[model samples]
Target: MTESVMPTYGRLDVAFTRGEGVWLYDEQGEAYLDALSGIAVCNLGHCHPAVSRAIAEQAQILMHTSNVYQVPLQSLLATKLTELSGMSQAFFCNSGAEANETAIKIARKYGHSKGIDKPVIIVMDGSFHGRTMATLTATGNPKVHAGFEPLVPGFVRVPYNDIDALRMAVSHWPEAVAVMLEPVQGEGGVKVPAAEYLDEVRTLCTQRKLLMMLDEVQTGIGRTGEWFAFQHAENSLPDVLMLAKGLGNGMPIGACLISGAAVDLLEPGNHGSTFGGNPLACRAALAVINTIETNSLLAHVTLMNQQIVAAFEHALSGAEGVQFRSKGFMFGIELPIACTELVKQALAKKVLINVTADKVVRLLPPLIMSADEANKMVNIVSELVLAFLATQPKASVA
Candidate 1:
């Protein structure tokens, strides 16, 4: 009941007892509309029946086995992932950080195979990769790196969505072997690059003979209304793609997919995970994919995204100093002032939303969220924002 038990998360007073579809219930029976969806980890909604059944069945059958033995579910899931992502091979892990670590190793090995002694990778500013040692070094925010000094080397930081800066960094760091980035910067305030930016990146990677790795941990699955966010663009696929978050709905699973020449970089013994591709996680991923396909959730995601974006724009377009930026379900409502306190107000009103980068109200709702649910979310947050803005001083309105 105190700080001695767990690290601080600045958590709200209420604790959720259960969740279904787009709603969560507190112990006292208060209902909260879940717009964050566990930070995009519940694309199919919490405890989806098919996914739940698969987990339950697999838990009874075989939950885990080491990487030493054959894992058929792992192989099956890999095949499905390759079909969905158009990648040549996959390396399964247990978290976004592990998937990214695999990506980092792949890039370095690819560089070494190409006869480069010291390989470097270009990461973007305002980007969030993961919290592990190597991934923290790859991350662009200094706040994640403040105490973790002597960060890993071989990483060159550049501004996001700036092709010129990327080119300059590649030229400056001759040992650079790859460019790693999130297709949509989720944790960094839901930032989306220009539509042509990914195309340019793909072209540059091809020309420079570098691996174009996309950290789709937050943008993959049906979150962006596509199998992968890059697929939204015409012929802009990456050589390497990292995935996690909603891949297994709530199950812990992460994967690094490789294609073109990068596929052969990781030999059998190069990397592995004890519980990465275990039967339980693989079955959950398979069920998640099947449910998405069967219910046409991808199309639903696109439709719901359009509806929600339009509604948010209509509601907040001329509301003093409010603005919205979105693509599919990943959205950020930017308020003129820092609205960190609004999280508490929204919770009091029984709505679950998150504020990121201080001023951006970031939302990554479940893909199956309906128009009614979306409206409820918009109305609750819109009222809260308008009320909060009205309380600010006139001089601060600017």
Candidate 2:
């Protein structure tokens, strides 16, 4: 099996046979609390009834008819997404990177439509857009760009949440036409900016006539205790909003929700996806959004977030260099020392978690996690952290 499978992922030894809500069961019937939620894809938890039913029903009805013909499910999903997002139009795709790739294309086209032959999109440092060529180039981490040289240009990098620097870049770069950043920097160790950051970015984009693009792949779809993280603010609106991850509740679906000045940027034949907006995917996404709304999961997520945060604080209180920043269920516990090995260690204890940006323990638990499960997650991880720190001997310097 290893011979045939690609060596792209450093997969874990344990193979999960099934998952429900927030728990995964391995082949041997061992249970693991899945705090990562398949890296935020299984938002409604594994095999959500509504989403599963939608998938099965749509499977019986239709699956793919391409973008050439009418896909009612696709149109319906778009309508609901735009209604939720306050966007005017939507272009469906299959993943976060693809959605972002579409957003990049839209921004470039919007710039060119204004006679700017080569448009420059201002991207933030520490941003994770996608793995495609354009998105990887736009990504801030130098490590992602190491092997992939001759990257796609037309993107200017700026420090995230820095208004003055962003404004300066716009004024300095004549070709700058758009500004892109995540609402909460999810992959950059779940970095949460100041409260006024999104408003400031929106104001700058509006005043500068630049498209404000938000990559909400990891932060969207009730993960942040709201329909989207931007909803936390009144004036938070992006011209090009990219979404994926939780949108389909595990089914592959990505969307580029456009509003304001950039709504009409894409033209026919300019860009499209063959499998994007297929009936099955659209139905899955619809079920996801509908289920979230019907079950009041947003409110649940908000309360769960508070409960989890309180537990984390209680667990780590008075511990030096130990603290957490969280919005809704998205959290990152920063430690005094690097602890990449914590992932394997935690897995050994049957609790799935991830370490990002070196020392930030990133936890994106399932939205349906009960208060009891949430407490269990916190307890296990807190014990793990305390144990790990206790085992480490003090370092001496000359």
- Misplaced by over 4 Å in model 2 are 396-398
What TM-score, to 2 decimals, does candidate 1 have?
0.98
**lDDT tens per residue, model 2, 291-336:** 8989999999999888999999999885667869999989999888
What TM-score, computed on C-alpha atoms, does each candidate reach? 0.98, 0.98
What's the lDDT for residue 1 in model 1? 46
Span of 10 residues, lowest total lDDT, candidate 2: 389-398
> What local lDDT score does residue 22 receive in model 2, on the 0 to 100 scale?
91
For model 2, the local distance difference test gives: 0.91
State the displacement of the C-alpha of residue 369, model 1, in Å, after optimal TM-score superposition. 0.6
At residue 261, candidate 1 shows an lDDT of 64
How close is each model in CA RMSD to the real structure?
A: 1.2, 1.4
